[model samples]
Target: MEDGLLSLKWNNHKITFFEILRVLREKANYTDATIAVEGKFYPVHKLVMSTCSEYFSEIFERTPCKSPVIVLKDVRSQDMDALLDYMYLGEVNVNQNDLASLLKTAECLRIKGLAVPDEDPTKFRKGQSDDRRESPPPKRRRHEDSSSQPLSQRPVSPTISASSKTTPPSRTPPLQHQTSSLPVSQSQDSVHDSIVDPPPMVKVEMEEADDPDDGYSRRDNSYDGGSVNEGDGDFGTELSKSEHDPDNYGSGSFPGPSIQPGGDLPWDEGDSSSFPPEGFSGDLPAGQQPQGAEGLELGWLGGNEAFRCHLCTVSCGSSTQLQRHVMTHTGEKPFSCHYCSHRTARKYNLKIHLRDVHGVPIDRRFARY
Candidate 1:
């Protein structure tokens, strides 16, 4: 128990350390060194890298350069990215396609715990074949076996045969037998008797009997069809229709609230109250402007702050702009020019390229600014 507890504690500490490293790498928090590979820079912590990799530690010790930028050669950017990811997360996704390159990179860096065992692929395939040969074939189902045989050859239970012989074969009774017991009324209303006596009386009694709330003699008021109150100017019909139709929940019609051109939304018109007064500059005299306005826009309490891009040194006024700028570094060009093979990172850039280079009119679909 003591040994198990110590093992558990050590495992927990290792997991916690990996989690801290992953967070630091993801957020680029307190990153002192940058690894430049294939024109892409990956920010990493020097202490973690030095402690984890002896090659990195030796390079840092031997080099006299003050800058923390280290350039890698021959190694693919994706493999280096995967290496860094494994170093931080303690686990990485490796497949047959990338396995060779990953192993080479790991061996070069002297990264521990990534050595592949010397096992032959043909031996594994032979073992699988031997196992398959030793396994027994699946047994056929009893029903299927019986179905494959002739009827005379198939076995039948004595009890089933006896029951089938005793039971009468099902057949539709003649109409004459059903009406023979009833006396035929020889009167002027004979047509009505023939039409109503056969099935209508039984159907009416069954429908009336199904209503448990009321007795069989009482009529169903809930049914709008064939009811005397149905002529009450379509109110019941409208109510029933509305209850059954899912689209007409509260009212029979669904109309969204009318939104006028520019005044319906608060954001449509810019809020002038949040901005400084007209012709008011920060460099002007303090007495010329409002008293509290100077420090209001300068301090952290003000909402005039901007989100800065961590990949590059560019700062943006909004998160959307910063995200668009980060995509340039990520090399994700989702928008492509329609006329030519030109592609751009932003939709607006694609539109501008199409208008200027391709001499094509910018359609409304690609006119996002």
Candidate 2:
């Protein structure tokens, strides 16, 4: 068998080269070309610009000059700067106000990978009906009979005609038994006496049933007839003991087999002992410091010590400040606006953009860490 060595690869050298070129452009070192926009000159490398942009390459080939200074018109200086940044770094900082102009500029210049998708006009218009018509109308409840109409919409029943109607028969009989039993004068005298004098009051005590199944027999506050059954067993004893004991009121405990914390209680997976006491310092063990301590300690700004970025020479007093500063280089935006396509590296910046640009109300839901 022939023995051969295998090699595993990780890093991309192309990206590293582009990052170095970006650093060189940012530092304005070794620049061979100049882009003049709005009375401002940005130093840039001609080879990098020509290779990245077709417009630049064509312009340079057609018009060769002693001094490689190209003047731009009708383009904001900031947009030009962002375009150059994207050409070198492969990323651009896009916002709501400048996105349209920058996209237009990129399209005009025939820049690759910077075009925005066209939005449908109907999506932003009001009172526009959907063309798909996919949703069916809501089902309505109706009477089972085909001829029956809803009560509200049904025609009123025809009134009885006086000519064809027959009178209903009298419901009352002669009442012979009542007349024979009670004389007319005696009944009248009795009714007159009752009206003159009110009836006497009678006391009637309500008796509760002895049955255990009867709900009224069991009272939460007091027992019926001041007695409890012996057959109730331990339940009655526990109830009485808990009712009379002040400490047991509202306490979720029973007389026998009570649960004890730290013994039978559910075990927490977190290491509670590792946490420092209330007054103790938050210092960790040797070589065991927290991974994102810089970002987490942004609120403690009294000390105000500086922390430097690993990729750049920018130094920030807090981790949060450093993280926000690093986004300018990496172009990583995690926070986004709900109403628009605006995004920012820090949440507060997104909130400010929403409030100032879009007239959105400041709410706690938009709070940035």
Candidate 3:
């Protein structure tokens, strides 16, 4: 074999890539013969043949004399160059895009066999798909994780990736949350007594004004994911006041005990209470603390930072002070076109911009490949 040429001998079959290259160089029968397999057809260039499975055998047998042979669907379409490389060298990685195509092509060409197929193809598909997904199996997860985690926590999500060419999702995370709101009432029923006997048509109660500060439209709070004790809480203002300020005994200062230190705990009560060396010293003093100390703890302030990096989420003492400081090294290109720049990180974003806004020449290259 020449330095760049490849050769292979299997049983009585002999194939040298140099032969095909010489034919191509001479333009002498270089064009592969075409043959139909199942619903599709492809050009078969070399005659090196093999029989592994029935489906493949049928396709291989049907290929006209000069047709080229492919490995699997995984290689034929997307990895055309790799397939060509394999045609010469007989090896390549089977990437996802061309896997099915290479397999289909191989099946068409009978690179495997026409019969003697696996008994349970569903198991085979499930195994391969499961492996490709690399997600925790439902049964394999801990009981809590299995019941609590969403399908996305596994190797894949319930829905396919938006960029996928087909219905079955690709390896990317299903990130976009598409919330579908349901109609409040099945019938066109108003808030009033739309019961058997309609109330008087006079408007009795004034309409409640929508609060500008509270912009979020109230969702149905009665959901499975809602807080278990949302409406009722044992530790209300009474418990909070007692815990934060134990100084107020039962003086007629007010209906409820006066808030001594005032305000609630920073962390959850259980977590904060755990550090109480003696647990609730319960010492109340004459309602007087030092200046700038009411509703504030000397333990806090200047000890540590509060606000964190908006992007990195690291702790920041003061966001205002950090604003210009953040520009020191983050090096993020803050300025960008509003439309396509945010949609993708690729420079070909201009293609999307042109297609979407300017009605310029459109190309589907980035849409998939």
Q: Write the per-residue lDDT of candidate 3 for residues 83-175, one digit (tens) a residue.
A: 332333333334433334333333222222110122222111221233332322111211111233232211111111112222111122222
RMSD of each: 40.0, 45.4, 34.3
lDDT scores in order: 0.32, 0.32, 0.23
**In order, how many clashes per candidate?**
0, 0, 34
Candidate 1 lDDT over residue span 1-369, tens digit each: 666654334658766876776776666777655554443446667676665454454334433332233433233455556567555654444333443455444433433333211121111111112312121111111121123322221011000000111111221111111122323222112223333333211110001111121111111111001001001122112122221111101110000000112221111111111011111111122232323221222222222224332221234576555444434433435567666677765677887888788776875344221
Model 2 lDDT at residue 165: 12
- Model 3 TM-score (2 dp): 0.19
Q: lDDT of candidate 3? A: 0.23
Show where candidate 1 strays beyond 4 Å.
1-11, 65-67, 115-369
| Runs in model 3 lying further than 4 Å from the true structure | 1-32, 35-42, 49-76, 79-88, 94-97, 104-110, 113-369
* Pairs with backbone N, CA or C atoms under 3 Å apart (clashes), candidate 2: none
**TM-score of every candidate relative to the true structure:** 0.29, 0.29, 0.19
